[model samples]
Target: MLPTRYVRHSPPKETTTSSVNEPKISVQVLVLGDIGRSPRMQYHAMSIAKHGGRVDFIGYQESTLNPGLVENSLITIVPLQPPPSLLRSNTLPFIFAGPLKVLWQIWSLYYTLGYQTKPARWLLVQNPPSIPTLFIALIICFFRNTHLIIDWHNYGWTILAGTKGPTHPFVMLSKHYEAILGSFAPTASFTVTNAMAKQLRSRPYNVRSPILTLHDRPAAIFQPISNSEARRAFLARIPETSGFAAAIMAGETKLLVSSTSWTPDEDFSLLLTALCHYAESTDKLPPILAIITGKGPQKQMYLDRIASLTSTSKLQNITVATAWLTAQDYATLLACADLGVCLHKSSSGVDLPMKVVDMFGAGLPVVGYAAYESWEELVKEGINGRGFTKSEELAAVFEELFADREGKQLARLRKGAVEEGSRRWDEEWDSVAGRLFGLCD
Candidate 1:
């Protein structure tokens, strides 16, 4: 038998503010990742705070929180302690134990909320680590009468499928479980792209609540910098590059930057191959410095590959550097680069890469690898950047962009990148957030 589809008859109405005498609205944001790393959730929290709500942000602890967020009186951060080493190291046990801990903490918070004065209460949760967490949240919301709002990034099942293949029993179970839970009617739901929104709407259990697209945007800190200034800053940050200082100072060097998650989904090997092709294709090519950012499970594997290339002298003229940069340093590094290479082939082919957005915000032209069609929205060939399927095609695109003797092509692409990047997607979040928090009139 086909599953019944739940549908909403009306779109969400604008939420109005209470009278001056009334208590302010309150929100509890639940995320399984580091709040510092989850920019979308952070933006939503900031928006709620901006609109006179008290936001309780609950998430895993990190080394630091955003300084501006820390200063916001309307927001209080509660960090979740990590699980014990035994559970953390065992994948299956951690999966079951982790959500149980989150459920307990949330229940404790719910108990605390009972003592507080009456106000509009909402729970905004980020998903994938989705299933058991959302399922638990639904139970709590049922008892507390708090409105639930889910920000869908991708299905936890799809992520599992990436690692464990589609036919795995766990993957199949997760997929079925997510569909069932995702269909419960919430106050509203949001996703990062229109494609993702469409996918969520099509879910059988989806109770047709208003699902809106909330695209990721670069923060204000990512602005354009002069090549000279950026190069100087880059050199200062990594003093080991003093050997290339003379070449960079003389304008005989090009900087290529790639931001990656270092996962299998992103084929960094393809990018390394492209670089080797770029080197061997032309002797006239100037010295190239490549900076690959972000740290993940596959960092050592890529580092070993880079070392192999170095030892073989295959890329003697090309210097590759990798670092896991802080937000501030990452932004600065993006601003200094000549070109950005995005190796991300989306794991689910639904979520767009925010790294490309940050790169564009820094006015850096990107050559991206597209696993699906939706990527075209960002990497428009000849408009802002180019997209490719194979290493050779990407190498060819790189050759054209970097090997231009007259410099006209590079200048034009840079202009396109800056123009396209200057459009602020972040500004749209304020209105969407207002609607989500019932702060809008």
Candidate 2:
């Protein structure tokens, strides 16, 4: 299931926030849970504080740490933890986890809203409306006479169901909640594509304000690097390419794929399996390294399965590598690779992998599985990289990223990512922050 969230409730008839002379209106915006060490949350919190207002964010304990740092901006990091698992293992019925999660959500909403002595003037929430927290947040706003902003990072149920395949009733109910809450609260939101924004508009109660999806990064990252220093950079960042020696190698080319995990979804398996097929067909099986960073529900199971596949196939070419690194280092590693690959479990049409944006931003030619139309659209086929939604399509992109036309064209296509970042995404955070804090208004 998707993580907990703070939802918006009924709109207020009137608000007292009109006076411009009001000394930086104290805005207490509470998220659904604690900030789980998410840099995204940190970035948002900092953005609010930058505007000289008080910002508070609540999220799960794993991602959101308490006692967070807030400077001049209106941001605070609130923390929370999931209730202990009632079942001994993850094999329990979805009905159980689903209800348990909702209970926690209810608790969070009550704690944040029912207890607020002074109602916050504005509330910011993610898109899923089923979250009691989001609904409770809206109640706080109504009582306090504030405004709301809903953030749609991705489709939670869509991403999770991609891996599990076929949803349980609980999952369907979760989606129903998402639809209801999303429709109920009107606010500015994030959309990966214009098509998605259109779908949101079709919703019965989607509040429309502004839709800003992922944008480009700093131009410096994508700037050209001379061939002379290319090898130096890749070799220097050896940690990223740790599986180089042990992974499968076909002919002269080495195949590599990478992905990160979210709560219920880990979407790269089909692509990885497809890459495995590619290795099987070729005469020379160069090292095929599958590197995964970060953690999620299926991480351990994935590692064991890949190792089993390698042992059974009697090919020493495939190896699994994992570690944690700073964002810059992660992007640097992508820059050093012979190719970049992203996988999405088919169900995950809702989420636009932030890493995909990062990959293109890093000047890496990305090979992504087309789970969302957003990624498919970004790839433009044969330009940035390729998307493989099915078992048959993976090897073709693998051939491109490793050999065929892909090898020779890598430099130019990779360079495109850098320009996209600088012009499209990275620097805009300041503008976004400014607007969120009411500086531009």
Candidate 3:
């Protein structure tokens, strides 16, 4: 349940002279989306609290939040009401729906920032809902004398362009809106990638911000389940694997996991096609239990398609299950799985997938889509994971990686993934964001 009222925390006092010189820190970590789905911002709140700063975490509480965030004394979860029903209706075209949603969001955000919350030294906000958020945040910061920091996950305009064509008037206007407001608070901006920083520095966007690249890293909960007993216990709890329990436990079948939002960015058809090809191949590869998790608009459509395929016996050698697991169960599944498949086709070519990071943290190798240039930063082809651009290519990669009876290639990739996973959230966050926010000693 969401907290019904706001309560602020004061930072602990120290008598040291250095403490006297340091700035008093309190930040409102704002996300204009679901709080549970916004892991990056969640990490930010945790890191801030760890560094002795107080955080008011604000977002819609549509899903379960991390207990760590909820339990922290330094962090407060402030829930925002979800948008109006009319804004969510598919019958309403975006041309009309977009403006109405923005207007409501502006009022809600203003009320929360202006009156409902305590005044803070900094306001760290997520971008890509940059439309009303950037505008409203700027206004609130100006009036309340709070410093604004925009964390650039991706461009709102580019994401908008993905649905409506790049030439759409709204897309163009959104780009201008982002460019104008996003350029403010020049020294206080952070981006997820160097590519984003470079883009923002050049051309029409020409942001003056001292953009720091703070890459996403897996949280502490995601770790390798090397103990066979632990793996067995996890598998036993998931009823979806009951049909092929022996095969999976005895290493006669492979567990392949993937997470998706079932959004337009990911083409599930490609994965289905590759799985079909894998089943038909006369290869030595084991049968697969492909489990995809997450809820989205296209989830039902894909579920129907998977059902249709199963009814016709087209996927005889493969079993597909879709689940909406809790965060802990999701981490355990990643740790127990043999491999992960990431179908993310980044809407903004500069943004990297957090799922890939989570998979690596579980010591699981990945087979990721290679459509975007930024994937190279995380995938590290032939090392930590392999990349494929087509269904046939994916099938071929799977055959090569999984066909060996000795499991040589899989072992090699898992070693690389484990090494990659060792570079975790705390170390990365403390160096970059910790210093930028003046939370470091």
Candidate 4:
């Protein structure tokens, strides 16, 4: 059972720090998410596993399980299901089943707890603390002599609400939980994008605490290819690519769009309008292929918004790719695209994203509109990508990036950045295996 809600996710003001001398502990990994289908951290964790250590997976069965995972790693998967009600679509009578879904994750976690063994050296808890399975793992780790590790993928506690830096009761409220979790988990570390890491280290949370972990995944390679040959292959697989791209070519200029899977709060409607205006005035419409990879709760809302926007503005090229694609193909397309988009609402809980890193890894740049410190940090002003908070600022930035020789130059620089990002990954977690596990020096 969850501990009594004494602090209500709030922590004391007294700050804490870790000694420079690293503490020793036995390490084993316990993961959440539909292990097979979870593309983001699952792969990163597996990458760490390849570095040499034991990786045990506790996840549900998914329809599109990666064949590679089953073939490659010695991962142990635990099958658990959310109540069937969670997966089934809700009806109008119910209004919203948001709370019900959250309950379902927690319910599954309860079962995950029963399957666990006592104590390992390291316990990586990917969160929102949404699922009961994770909490159970935390408790089990606590009992079995394992220290809990927080990946701050959720940063749920630090959520702010808008384009500006911080705001109102939300900020104050978020601060309380951030501190509480800071003290509560000794082995905590944040896997934040550059912007978040920079902010947490300098402003809110200090670095030495070992609580702020930078999630330094390699960036995608963004290279421009006028591929006549590969284009055919891409078109064949992408079905409707010819008509979609062609129609959109005359269809919309500078199409402002967003991913469908992202929550509605991080909506890019205002930004889309700005992009539309930029195109109208400049005669350079930036067509958008808004590929909403993976279905999430907000998919329908996004589709509706996209449909509405396209119909009114009658923007030509703004299209959506809702179909599932293999991970490699997914990476390839994102890397090949003109630009990638992301938005982090102030109300965003733990706004860490694998896409931001993957964007950079694929050598593609990202344009992020962030409220809290997350993907926003990755856009180094004139460097890897653009980070915007205001809708007004977006079109101008996008135009600047797409215009002349400068845009191509920027793309190259962004691609070059992937090297440094890869180095960061190797540097940060290179010794993670040795440290977490009793591996060789």
Candidate 5:
């Protein structure tokens, strides 16, 4: 099991002579995607700002800045021009021009950083467009005398390999290129899980830098909600779910919530198939209000599939509703749910899903599809949640949890889920911020 205690580090004690000479710390965060979609980056920026460091954020202008971030005086938002049509549309030109576009953005970043009056203390960058951006950022930091911090979610090369096969020339080239660049000295390196940290340590590159594990934690925004409040908020957010809302109000339905990006990594069909099996095997099942949230490339395809299933009367007792939700609405929906379903299978088999963490924060028990070996640390079977590897097994789990008319099993799991959520990362990001800023003495 993963340790429950948060990682803590004591900063070096300072003498009176050195105390007067401490320079003001500043950080510049560079990302190639939408800032709003990048929650980890947001957390890093907020952590730095909260610890008295000024932050300059550079990213594309596709999404609005978070409302809280907009009002913060310690942070400045510098929007980059949106990528060209070919890159935005996911077309053939993207494969060739994507690196060039990232290079161009880094060039733009150089000018933005050059215009600053004070030299930044740290340059924090997210990887995946890893090699080219890292190569350029390292050279820039070398000349500017700034420390570099690379946060690894997964390799961009591995994502490409998933589509083009592991032996593809591009994949082979990326692996070699990343190794050469990643070996250079950096202030610190971070990954999302202990398993991923192990993978980074075992790489062929001779990186002497500390590789830290920083799992995703929910912000204070998500909290448990009363059943009545959750049902009302869910209905307000998704009016099309009136039938389900009615059932909820009548005390005749159980709410099942699942959040997805609708991407290839998550297998939504598995959940659908399990639902079908559960519906067919049980006769007097309670009405279920299943809400699936988020928008992505495969959304339309899944919507069509759901429509087809409903039209054919495959799932009779279950009412499935899919909608895109705002952050507040999403949290409220989760807070009200009796059970949360997670279908994420990591693309690199390393990164854990932030969605599940959000669910835990709301004290909702989960039925998750097991994709990684490290999942047992968080989703303890029959404790807070259950994990299944097959459709039949998942269906059985659903039956075991909800099929009890007395709600005894679900009440037990719910209590455990609340306890787990309460203990989910007891330490705040302020400690991480203190370590990054050399604040501890």
Candidate 6:
């Protein structure tokens, strides 16, 4: 049987010449990135499907999707073709590969939307890979008479500036392209943060769009563990974590967990340096087993560093483990851990980290990076979590949180996280996005 959330209420059968139970609206939810990795778009599709709207869900099928989404009858998965393999070659210059990749995506996306799929009433797309996607989606929507809605996750230009300097001609050009096309749907667009919406409305971009802020919320699977035994049972099931189960269950070791994409935005070095501080300190702190999860381009590079750090006699109190967990297992692991640590320094300060949202949902206190101004919006320092810009600051926070063996401070933060997690995705979506999509009153 499907989970209660997955179970759909089928519309009544047609009684006359016209189908009475047919969905009144059909939406095309687009993401240029991997569908499995894009949880926000998936949630949008699920919400649409739940409210009797047909959703043509489109993106690259890079990983396993949520079972609930896969089982949804009202939603259709429209897989986008992955870009050329040459794009990944380190030897091939990006100047040559970048244009080729964009051209390929343009042709592929145009073909998928124009020829393969049926026309949707609304076309909702994720931005940041905005160059060709936004242009191509705009053309398709214009010709098809569909309403175009750009879901601004972050600025493509800002993310590009991370690699190429902000002054670079290519980055500047990309910014203009994004800003112009993104401003098309003035009143119908959405953003993840108010700061982003404010920027679009005020700056050189000057978007007329009333970009609504639709904050990310945890899915139903992200819930607090009821007891120690339940947490231990969950830990024992995963092969990578099974060895630490007994120690965790016995309360002899503090379990710290973090999830990362091993991307450029996340400063893993800060986390490693902080742990090094914890190891070298003379203070008698409890042994910590830090589990860093996620697979990405930079995983092996960090894994080698972890290996070198452990070889030295200077770091004895800390054990660092890495794993790529299934979605359900990841939630369970977060619930079982003592604390959550985030290193996601957002490319645009406005956007919040969904990983932090997931941690709070599992009732775990977080210690997150504080370089970005927007960190305060999600992680209220000294409340649900603490934020630090430097390794020393993070190390000090760890000392303070873990100083008491009884964990009074950790308990207080955990209580705050539980309160924050009380609100789930369904209610949030119904209240905000449901109205925008005309799915609910």
lDDT of the candidates, in the order given = 0.74, 0.55, 0.85, 0.52, 0.73, 0.83
- Ten-residue region with minimum lDDT total, candidate 6: 11-20
Q: How far off is residue 120 in model 6, in Å?
A: 0.5
**lDDT by residue (tens digit), candidate 3, 1-441:** 112233224332322223323424778999999999999999999998877777899989998888889888878898887788879887798879888888889888888877778778789999978979888888767665677889999888888888998999999999888898887653378888888888888876788868888999999989998888888878887887766666777888989999999998888988999988898888667889999999899999999999999898889789999888888899999998888999988777889889999999999999999888678878888889999989999989878877887788988999999999999999999999898778774
C-alpha RMSD of each candidate structure in angstroms = 5.8, 6.0, 4.2, 8.3, 6.8, 5.9
Clashing residue pairs for model 6 = none
Ten contiguous residues minimizing lDDT sum, candidate 2 = 1-10
Q: List TM-scores for all candidates, in order.
A: 0.86, 0.77, 0.94, 0.71, 0.87, 0.94
Model 5's alpha-carbon lDDT is 0.73
Candidate 3 vs candidate 5, lDDT winner: 3
What order do you get sorting by lDDT, best first? Answer: 3, 6, 1, 5, 2, 4
Residue by residue across 43-129, what tens digits does model 5's lDDT show? Answer: 777766655567788776566566667787777887766656665565656467757666676666655555532346677888776
User: Whose lDDT is higher: candidate 3's or candidate 6's?
Assistant: 3
What's the CA error at residue 18 for candidate 4, in Å? 31
lDDT tens string, model 2, 397-429?
565555543346665666655545445332565
lDDT of 4 by residue, 1-441 (tens): 433321122221211222212223323344455665555445545544554444455566665655545654444455667457544566523324544655676666654543443234566666544234344655665555456666655544433334224655545655655645544554656555545444545535554455455555552232333464563466446753544554333333222223434555566475556556554654554555555566667667756876786778654544555656666676666644556677655454335555566666666666777555444445565566666778777767766765643357555656654643554454455454234434424
> Per-residue lDDT for 1-441 in model 1, tens only?
111121112332323454323325778787777788787788777777776777788777675677667998878887665545554555556458656655665554443333332223777889877755677667656655678888887778888788879998878888888887887746788887788888777754454888888777777878888757656857666654556665655657887889887898888999899889887884577778888877678899989989999899888688898776677777877776778998877767888888888888888888898768469767778878888889899878877876776667767778888887886655767667676555764
Q: In model 2, where do residues sit more than 4 Å from their true spots?
A: 1-34, 37-39, 63-74, 87-92, 113-119, 156-172, 204-257, 262-267, 283-286, 313-316, 346-350, 404-406, 424-433
- lDDT per residue as tens, model 6, 1-441: 223332224422222221225875788999988999998899899888887888899889989998878898878899999876777567678788888888889888987887778777788999878979988887776666677888888889888999898999989999888878777643377878777778878766777856787888888989999787788788898876688889877667889999999989898999999999988888888888999998888999999998999897546878899988889889998999999999988887888889999999999899999787677878887789999999999999988888777888988999999888889989888888888877777
Query: Which pairs of residues have clashing backbones in candidate 5?
Result: none
Error of 1 at 380 (Å): 1.3
Say which candidate scores most in lDDT.
Answer: 3
